[model samples]
Target: MNFDFIRRDINAQKAKSQYRQLVCNSAASKGKEIVINGKNYVNFSSNDYLGLNNHLEINKALQEGADKFGVCASSSSLVTGYHYAHQALEDDICQWLNKPKCLLFSSGFSANLALFQALGKSEQSHFYLDKLSHASMIDGAYHSKAIVKRFQHNNIEHLTELLNRSGKYSTGFSNKLVASEGVFSMDGCQAKVVELAQLAKSEQAWLYLDDAHSIGVIGKEGQGSNYFADIDITMATMGKAIGTSGAFLTCSEELYEYLVNFSRHYIYSTAISPAIAWATKKSIELIKKEHWRREKICELSVLFTKLLAENVELVTTESSIHAIIIGDEKKALNVSEQLKKQGIWLTAIRPPTVANNSSRLRVTICASHNDKDIRCLAECINKAIT
Candidate 1:
């Protein structure tokens, strides 16, 4: 059969306001600028909150790693690809998070999938998650064989209700796992990690937090929400904060061993380049020593929020990610385009990326951005809004 139905559906999406298109970014220069569609734009859509991606030292470290280990590992970690660099990086992550053990994954997405599929599957197990958790976490729950229940976003009471009810089903399953994003990617708000941890403890459930945005972007010394929340199973990605590739999970030695032996994603995927691990080691050092990066991000976040609040309708955020709440998807897209016309680049985030009726322009601030960058962004957004 011809796939004209698919084509017609796509065209109907454009007519009904759901079609999507990708814009290619040709080049990116540091200090808050990116080139797209042959034009320069002030970038406010990147996740490099600490500005580590363009750090000269990080570049040097990556180069050194490459010189030592080349671009690719010969096999998977379960095979012979596990190198000294990989071991060192894993050690550093465990030390940083104060976890007894850590296991590396090819990506944060895979790590989430593997964790749920491997740990949350049981006739006696149930998976509970925040309604607004990351896509990976949601997908993991879908892939899991356990019963899945999503509580209201950041609603601790609702979560507690779920935990209490889960006990009634103990005849069917003996395990419960709670998953959430430490820092929500769209709204930039943090989960009540401590509260969740305590609830999980009282209910005898396992708590899993994905710290993709928070690690290297929040917490003391960038230890992530786990330090503040005292969580046991925490996943962090190196690509965002460490300015490298891959992801890892920090947990007790028992869980670590279980994942190594049972997590299919970890066992099946090709090992990341060992050089990336070496660069991760250096990144961990910078995350510790470069205390000023954290301070600078906090200051810039406040400045941007303050300036935007004076004009655009926006939410106040403690983290580097901020949102200008524009309700309709088409309206958000038009506003994003208007800002882009002024050489300011911000993505118009739409549902299903976020909840329907909550579409907005997501603004991500980075340490590399200066006051001028924030001021220009504020001015451009003001013009776009008006």
Candidate 2:
């Protein structure tokens, strides 16, 4: 029962499996390029889909918020830390998503953890998830102490079968809650949200959509995948789309208030800086005021997919995320290294991040990237593959 020996054994296995995490140093600029281990390269791996990371207006807003609210709230939200900025941002998200209410968390991970832990009852209730849902969701389900079931990714039939089986066992408890990502992070495939929503309705299950990757990049005004589908609760992260830090949940007013009262993650954790909340409010405004960004990103994504298809194996995704499946971990790593050497950088997405045998280079294209940047990326990819 020596835990140190057990930990060492696990670390050894991870090292042997090439599952070690690597660090990359980022440089400041248009935010499209970054420096990794002192090497300068064009970045194709960030989640800043609109290149707002270095936006002047965002910076100005941040300064303004900081000047007005100082650097820290210095307490948890339930302990007098919720500022006007926090309330404002929450309201903004509620309005944007057209929800009756919204609640904020420090990060998307925390938000999911709070939601699943609060809503997913232990044993008496079950949580069903997509196989490809983010680790946050899976970890949250595990933490929820619920009976966890997973259906095959995007396989409505598998989901339906699972739901049908659960229906027979609903005599003693809450049935089940269905959860999924709007966009699969590594593969870039979208959830069959509309279909899943209908299935949830017919099966009498509550639906939770974590639209972290799609919130800022998908839907008409970026209300996220729920706009295209029906969902009882929609979770999003400001860090991804709004170019700020923190997570949000938009749902019915009752559920929102319930979470504020009962969710441990929300009630216990230190609230985000009021300045960040203020900055996020401005970011949302910018995202709504400018509709062209979403359209431009969609166009770039399609263009990147089409061009990459000509030279290498690429997954067809309409979202901002485009992946080149290399299958083997080592080969994916090598391909990523080769691309980086050619001044193009994309992370080698490997097993554990994705399923076994689905390692890939997840290239994220932002609207800030011009056609020439994408063309250059295509050229680099072609050359690297050759």
Candidate 3:
């Protein structure tokens, strides 16, 4: 394999101001603050929407789990790795989401890949996805044997039209799955879950939602899209507002059994840490019981929107993420840099993570953020953009 193309591509990315790099945090981040390069900044780039990252109860549960179940699962779930902790966690999730069964994976990406690939087993499998669906969903759908169609972002009419057109081709053996993100990661806007559920029912199709961004932020009890509609299959990550690690998919008992027997990702990969699963149960408990966290995020988000300058173009959303569109890749990077200098850690989101020339500042407002944090961030963003 030639390494020259890799170098060329990287150089091209740098030239276009699209090169990516990782920055390590020096310490465990607290509510709304992260230490990077020996300086603390208000962290508007985190997905810890409910601010439960370092909570005492969660930590205690983790410790207890480690002592009880050990840190590692030691092998794949089918290979005697699944523990009591995992079972308990799955049960907790099923109960919380009001689903018949739940399956856990090491990460949201893996969970998505598993679900899509498992469902897309044959040429008769048809998947209709949102154009703005996450990369994992796209990869899984395209890589599988399924015939995949993408409707315009959150365009129900387009989705309905596609489903109608494809209705004639449906057969008893064919599987039709309509997939979307509950809260779009980049745009931070919600999908029409209720409408999608209705369409799926009318079309005799299955609905799959990746609620990675919505699980701990939406709904009265953080049940996400599940609170609004009865989705066929729902996946959410524990890393975000749940403030742990791993991901889960909630589905019917039949689908759960099928995935367990056939899903390559789930069958081959090791299960998530039982310790984390135990901790995640505790996290979800807090997410359910403490409505104040969700309320705080809403309050802070409103304050942020109100404080933003008149000229700043922001994607209005009820979720934790807020995208400020900055068209040029270079301009977005510069704006991010300006905010960094002002002691606000906001990331510049650019293509191909987003569409070409749709570069943005993807600000995540967690419950930990206060009125002061929102105000300061808005003021800094206004200054930087202006």
Candidate 4:
């Protein structure tokens, strides 16, 4: 096949200021600093919301897990790869979320694909997703056989209308799933968890929450969306605040067994490293006991909002993410460069990752960040944008 179209597409992206390139970080430490090209900068683009990355206790647990269960699982969970570490991690998640059972995956993407694809087995399966849902959730929902509809972001009235429409035409589908992110990744705004849960119950639909961004940052014990409502199913990743690797889906025992038997992603792929699973248990333990970390994020976030200039607009969110909207893609990149020059590493979020003309500086405030860091960041951002 001719590859000229690939070059054309690349050129088009560059022309539109939408081209993306990977930057190598020589080192990342304490979830608040990264070394790129031998220059260290305060990291404000990380998803480590609770600032648990490279934590001492979690690191020690990882080493102990390796010593006890070895580093790798060597095979898929359906095979001989299911180990004590994996089972223990699953149990920990189930207990933390107060769910009947939990199943582990290599990442949040795989977990989402597994859940949607498994449940969306027939034409009767309908999925209503939030407009700002993560890419993984969108991909999984579209890839499934289910009829998918997207509602306005955080708009329960819109979702209710869509659900009513789906009910009017529903005849063959076995189930209806309503999927949303507990905390939107790009905007950092939260979904209406309580309202969605109530709507799902009233409509007799299954509520699925992708709590990847909320898990380690919300609730008194970091229970995330589960703290707001009794969601039917929830998925969260360990790579963020949990300071480990892998993802997990918490659900009813029947759903767990069904995924084990029928979810191709789970059945075909090798299990996550046993060592990481063991480390995750320790991470959750720390998350539960360390209320100070959550408080730190809140305190820092408030400081950041207070420090910004009057003209600068920020998306209000209780989560660690804060979006400073800069409509033009090129302008957003320029502002990002200016922040970098001032020793802050904030990324420009552009089209496709967000809506058209909604380019922004996606700022992540971690617990590791001090008041000084927030003040400096805010000053730099205010000066750069203005």
Q: lDDT of each structure?
A: 0.85, 0.84, 0.93, 0.92
lDDT of 4 by residue, 106-185 (tens): 99999999999898878788899999889999999899898899999899999999999877876654488999999999
Please give the RMSD of candidate 2 to the true structure: 2.0
In the range 1-386, model 2's lDDT, one tens digit per residue, is 65679778778757645566667575565678788778787789889997778688888888998998876988998998988988998888888877788888889999999999998756777899999899999999998778899999899999999888877767775657899999988878899999989998987788999899989788777878867876799988888768888888888989888888889998999899999988888888888878898998888877776776465888878888888878888888888888877888788888777778888889999877889989999878877775
Candidate 2, residue 69: the lDDT equals 85
lDDT of 1: 0.85
* lDDT tens digits, residue span 241-288, model 3: 999999999999999999999999999999899999999999999999
> Which residue ranges in model 1 land beyond 4 Å of their true spot?
2-5, 309-311
TM-score for all models, in order of appearance: 0.96, 0.94, 0.98, 0.98
The regions of model 4 sitting more than 4 angstroms off are 172-174
Better-scoring candidate (TM-score), 2 or 4: 4
Between candidates 1 and 2, which one is better according to TM-score?
Answer: 1
Q: Which 10-residue window of candidate 2 scores lowest in summed lDDT?
A: 13-22
* Model 2, CA-based lDDT: 0.84
Q: What lDDT tens digits, residue by residue, belong to model 1 across residues 1-386?
A: 68779988888878745678887878855757788878998889988788887677777888898899877888888998888888888898888888888888889999999998987667567889999888999888888887899999999999998888778756654788888998999999998988999998988888899999999878778987977877879998988877888999999889888888888898888899988888889888999889888898899888877776465668767888898888888999899889888888999888778778888999998888889988899878887886
Clash pairs, model 4 backbone: 124-172, 124-173
On TM-score, the stronger of 2 and 3 is: 3
In terms of lDDT, the best-performing candidate is: 3
lDDT accuracy of residue 94 in candidate 3: 89
CA shift of 103, model 4, Å? 0.6
